[model samples]
Target: MPYTGPQSVDRALEMLDAVADAGGPVSAKALARRLECSLSTAYHLLAPLTERGYLVRTAQGYALGPRIPGLQRSLMQHLEPVPRMADVLAGLRRATGAEAYYTAYRGGLITVVDTTAPVTDTGNPFTPGRETRAHATAHGKALLAELPRPVLRRYLAEHGMPRLTRATITCAEVLEAELSRVRGQGFAVSVGEVDPAYTCLAVALPRGREGGRGRDGGAVHALSVSLPTGEFRRRPQEIRAALAQAAAGCG
Candidate 1:
C-alpha cells in the first residue's frame, strides 16, 4: 500500500479489544499497561469511543456504553430479528398509530438505542445518544426491575429522588412498591413520568454474548416503546408484547 495506517489507531483498537474482553471496565493505567503505552495515549484512544457513545465510565472502571446495543439494534432493525426478526414493530406501529422507541440501560441511565416514529407523527426533536433519567423512564424501570434489592436501595439512597412530573415516583417507599410490581411483571410502564404528554413501556432484554452496559455503568439493556398518553392508553399491551419480541431478537 502507498500509505500506512496510523500506529496510534492500531494501538487504540488493541486497547478497546482488551477492555471489552475483560467483561468490565478497566482503569486508564491498567489499559495503558495492556497496550504497552502511556496512560495519556490510552485516554486519547478512549476519548473517541466515549464521544461515540461506545464506552462509559464507572465507579470501578471504564466499560462498554449502552450505545453498542443501539448499533446492533440499527443493524437488526431492517434485517430479520434473530431468525432475522422482521416487521413486528411495523405491525405494532400500525396497531397503535404513534411513535415508538427501543431503549436499554447503560451508565446508570437509559439510552435510546433506536427509535421509530410515524410518518404522520408530530413529536419532539430528540435524537439518539441521549442519556435519560433511569427513574423516570420505563426502559430504566425494566432494567431496575432486575436490580438486586440492595443495589437498588443503595442507588436510590445515593441519587435521591427527583420528580420530573406529578406522576413521577419520587418517594422511596412508592418507588419500591412500583419496582416490586415491575419485577413481578417482568416489564415496566411509565405514565407521563419522563415527559408529561408521553408514556413509555419497557422490558429488559437478556444480555447477549457480551453482558452488561457498555464498558461503563454495568447495567443491562431494555426494550422500550413510547407513545402519546392518548395512544398508550388504548394499546398498552400491544406495545409490551411487541417490545418483548424485539428484546428476544436482540441477540
Candidate 2:
C-alpha cells in the first residue's frame, strides 16, 4: 500500500511496470530480466503484490490485478482530461442511450479513466479502473492497432491470442488481419467478442498537443461505446459515427 524506502519495494515496482508495459501478462522470468534482478528476487518482489491482489496469476500468466486499474483511475480522477472525457461519455450515453467509456494508454495497458451508462440500461460490466481485454475488446484492438507495426507485432507474438468467447479472435494471424483492417479504418469494433450480449466500438484517441513520451506516443486516449446486443445490431453505423464524433471533440 504505502511505499516505504526499501530497495526490494523499488525493484518490485519496476517489475510491475515491466508487466504493465508488456500490454499483457508477463512471466516472472521476463519480468526479472526487465527489472534486471535475479529470478528469486523477482518472485520475492511479486509475492506480496500477488497476495494483496494487485497482480493476478492466470492460466495465461501474470496480468494486472483488477485493483491496480482501480487505483490508477482514482489517481487520474483528479485530472482535467478525465472529467472532460466523463462529460463526453455522458453526452454519448444521452445521444445513443448506451454505455460509454473513456480509456487512456500510457505505458503498455489501456485502462478506463471513466464511464457513463444510460439510465435505462444495465450498464457496462467493466468501468473506471477496470482492465479492458486487449484482444476481445474494441478498445483493446484499437489500441493495438494504434501501435507501430513492429512494436505491435512483437507484442502479439509474445502474448498469443486466447479465446474469451466463441467470438474471440483465436489466432494471431486472424487478429493481425483484423488489426490491419482497423488501422485502415481508423477504429475497431467488437461484436460479442467480449461478451455474447455486448457490442463495443472504439475510435483512436485524438493526439494531444505534442510533447509527450510513450511507445506509440501519438494517441494518448481512446473513446469507446459499449451497449447491449440488439441495439448495436440495429444501429451499428450510427454508434460508430457517434464514437468518432466524440473522439473528434478532443483538443
Candidate 3:
C-alpha cells in the first residue's frame, strides 16, 4: 500500500510501541522484523530515539530509556485528579474491600487517572493509563453510557469493540443495549469482561468542567471498584453502596 501518512513519524512511534510491548530490551533486528521494515531503516529510527534518550542500547538489546520515566511522570501530573477524589477512592477501597479506580474520558480516550488497592494485593490489573477497551470495562461503559449517540458512534468507530474475554461485548448493537441498561440503572458492571477472575462495578460522576471535551462539551468522570469474581458476586449490593457513597463524597 502507498504510504500517504508521515511514514517516518508513524514508524518511529510504532517502534516505541513495539519496544514497550516487548517488556524488556529488544534487538534492532527483532524490531525491524516485527515492524516489517528494513534493518537499515530500523537503525535509522533507533539512532534518533537513542539520541533523544527515548531508547538506550544495552548489551542485551535496546531498552526503554531515562526519558520514559519523565514522560510518564509528566502524563501522571497532567492527569492527576483532585486531592479529594484520591481520598474518596482510598475510602472506597477500605469500605468495600476492593480495588478502587477513578477514571476520566477525555481526548477521545478513557484513562485511569488513579487507583487504590489493599496493601497486600499484588495482582491488580487496571493501572494509570489509557484504557483501549472501553466496551469491555465497567468504568469505560459508565462513561460511554453518558455520551450522546453520535459521539458514542464515533468512539466505537475509532476504537472498535475488541473481545478481551468471552464475556466482552464484541457486537456494537449488543454493547449499545448494555449501555442503555447502564443509563437506566445509573451504574455499569463488568462480569469478567476484562479479566475472567474479577468483576467490576462503576458509576459515572457528574460531568467535569475541564478536560474530557468531546463534541458534546464536558469531560466524563467515573468511579469503579473491582474484586474477585466470587467475592463480587457474594457482596454486589455492599460494593455498590460503597461505590455510590464514594461518588457522592467526590461531588
Model 3 residue pairs with clashes: none
Residue 50 lDDT in candidate 1: 77
Instruction: Please state every model's RMSD to the true fold in angstroms.
Output: 12.1, 9.7, 3.8
Better of 1 and 2 by lDDT: 2
TM-score of 2: 0.64
- Residue-level lDDT of model 1, residues 179-243, one tens digit each, is 88988988888889868998888777666313332322353656667778887778677766676
Give the winner by TM-score: 2 or 3: 3
Q: Candidate 3: minimum summed lDDT over ten consecutive residues — where?
A: 209-218
Consecutive 10-residue window with the lowest summed lDDT within model 1: 77-86
C-alpha positional error of residue 105 in candidate 2 after TM-score superposition, expressed in Å: 1.9
**Candidate 2, residue 219: how far the Cα is off, in Å:** 5.4
TM-score of each: 0.55, 0.64, 0.80
Question: How many residue pairs clash (N, CA or C atoms closer than 3 angstroms) in each of the candidate models, in the order given?
Answer: 15, 0, 0
Which is the leading candidate under lDDT?
3
Instruction: Tell me the tens digit of each residue's lDDT in model 2 across 112-144.
Output: 767785433434565555464677888878777
